[model samples]
Target: MAKLFTPYKLKNMELKNRVVMPPMCQYSVDTKDGMPNDWHQVHYISRAVGGTGLIIVEMTAVHPDGRITDQDTGIWDDRFIPAYRQMVDAVHSYGTKIGIQLGHAGRKAEDANPPVAPSAVRYDGEGYKEPRALTTAEVEEMIEAYAEGARRAVEAGFDTVEIHGAHGYLIHQFHSPLVNQREDEYGQDLPLFGERVVQAVRKVVPADMPVIMRVSAREYVDGGYDVDYITEVCRRYRDAGADIMHVSSGGEGPVGAGGMPVGPGYQVEMAAQLKRALDMPVIAVGILDEYEDAEQVLENDQADLVAIGRAMLRDPYWAVHAAKALQAEADVPVQYARGYRH
Candidate 1:
């Protein structure tokens, strides 16, 4: 059997295959209320029909100001639960597990009234304005927003929840020393923000529901957190109740400073390194485009799971096609079976 078609278990969740549709911002939601509309339903349902074992929805904000785009999905209020529930139900109907990526954009919040961060540093050239420093009380509120978002995710019937701690977002800003220059508790310690977020989310999420931490392993900038630092962060997050480490790189310091050079499985080594250093499951993402590449990552035990982003966007049926090319039995939809024969 092809390694990519093999089933894997993370905590209590069993994924039918290693093919995961990583979260990609659609910027397609209705801006009026941050609700999932027909566009989201069609976009996500297409992936499910196309045959990905796991489908992680795009970066969903815990609060309105946390959005990367005005059209991004939001789980901040109970009103949004029904829309997500409809989408989740649709994805599950196709026998695919669905997960949500919950996050706060911090200083990167893409509006005039962006939320406060640990510092006032602007993400240079990323079009993000300098944000005000969040007061301790406001920080506590943001933590509650995350916990509440997790609760709503449960209500929405998602199989899992992933905390967005990478790509120089709100949590990433707190983790990078270059961005977080405060002398307070959140900045005096490197892992303070991440630790708190994990702990808070765990408190609200069901114990059986896996909470994955998506981390940017290498900041890829001077004075930014490197693999060593991220490895340590992974260890700490595991201790704080993270079920898996979804390893990806870039998005620290200046916009382009941490830009990861694109190539096949470019960031797989980060997952491989973290797998060696930690006892938790590690997911390798970025530039994973083919069956052999994914097989190598799994066969070598570099990553317990493989996540595909842009490639999956290009071809939602990539997983089923890869399974066929690799000569593995893939669960292709009956509607498309005839095309596969030719």
Candidate 2:
């Protein structure tokens, strides 16, 4: 059996394979209520039936105004727990572990009358609104929001909780020197906000369930932080109780003099660096959709897990196909077994 198919355990979460369906926003909340409707459930459960080992649900806002758009999901209140629990129970029936990425869009909140960020910097995009700097009290409030979100995720019976600190969101804005220009403690210490978020999330979650922190390990903006600097930032997150780092790059925008790398496994080396630097498990993402490309990451020990975003979006049965291609043992759904034969 290929190493990718081998059972891998992180904390108390045991995955049947190394394949991870990273969080990708579906923007399906047409009702503007931030509830995970039937569409969201079917979207994820289909992948669960397709043989994915773990599925990280898309960015779920920790606050109402923290959404990128009205269509994104939010879990700011206790009312969302029952609905999330319903989806979680169904996904579990397929023998797959599921998690939710708790995030706040911050300056990227398109509908916000005035988006909030660590600083008053605009996202440098046309549709984005200029953001106001978060006051110290509001920053503290956001931290509590993250904790409450995790508490709700626990109630929903999610296997784990991932803090979406990547992609220039609220947490990312606080950590990025390019975006954060505050004079307060948060500005003085870039990783402070993210570290506090991890600590807060760690408090609400079970001791055995690992806290995953997804971060942009490398920024694409010309003056953005490099892999080494971001690695150190992630080191603080690890110390703050983040058990795993979901390594991804870019999202700060504008291709710099050094362009963003494209093609297969481009971010593998960065994930490998973080894994070595932090000495903890890391999930590598970035065009790693091919079966062999995903396998080699595990085979060569570049990362602990590989995330396939676009590929999984295109085919929910991706994991099943990869299992067949690699000739590895996978729990193909009994209903679909006949369809998977070579």
Total colliding residue pairs, candidate 2: 0
Candidate 1 residue spans exceeding 4 A from truth: 255-260
lDDT of 1 at 261: 70
Clash pairs, model 1 backbone: none
lDDT of 1 by residue, 1-342 (tens): 888888887767788888888888888876656898898898888888877889999999998889887878889999989989999999888888999999988888776385578888887755668799888778778888999999999999999999999998988888888888887788788788888889999998888889999999987666667788888877888999899889988776553444657799889988889988896788899887877888899999899889988888889888888888899997888887888785
Task: Give me the displacement of residue 62 in model 1, in angstroms.
Answer: 0.3
TM-score of 2: 0.99
Candidate that scores best on lDDT: 2
> How much lDDT does candidate 1 score?
0.86
lDDT of residue 21 for candidate 2: 96
Candidate 2 at 153: error in angstroms? 0.2
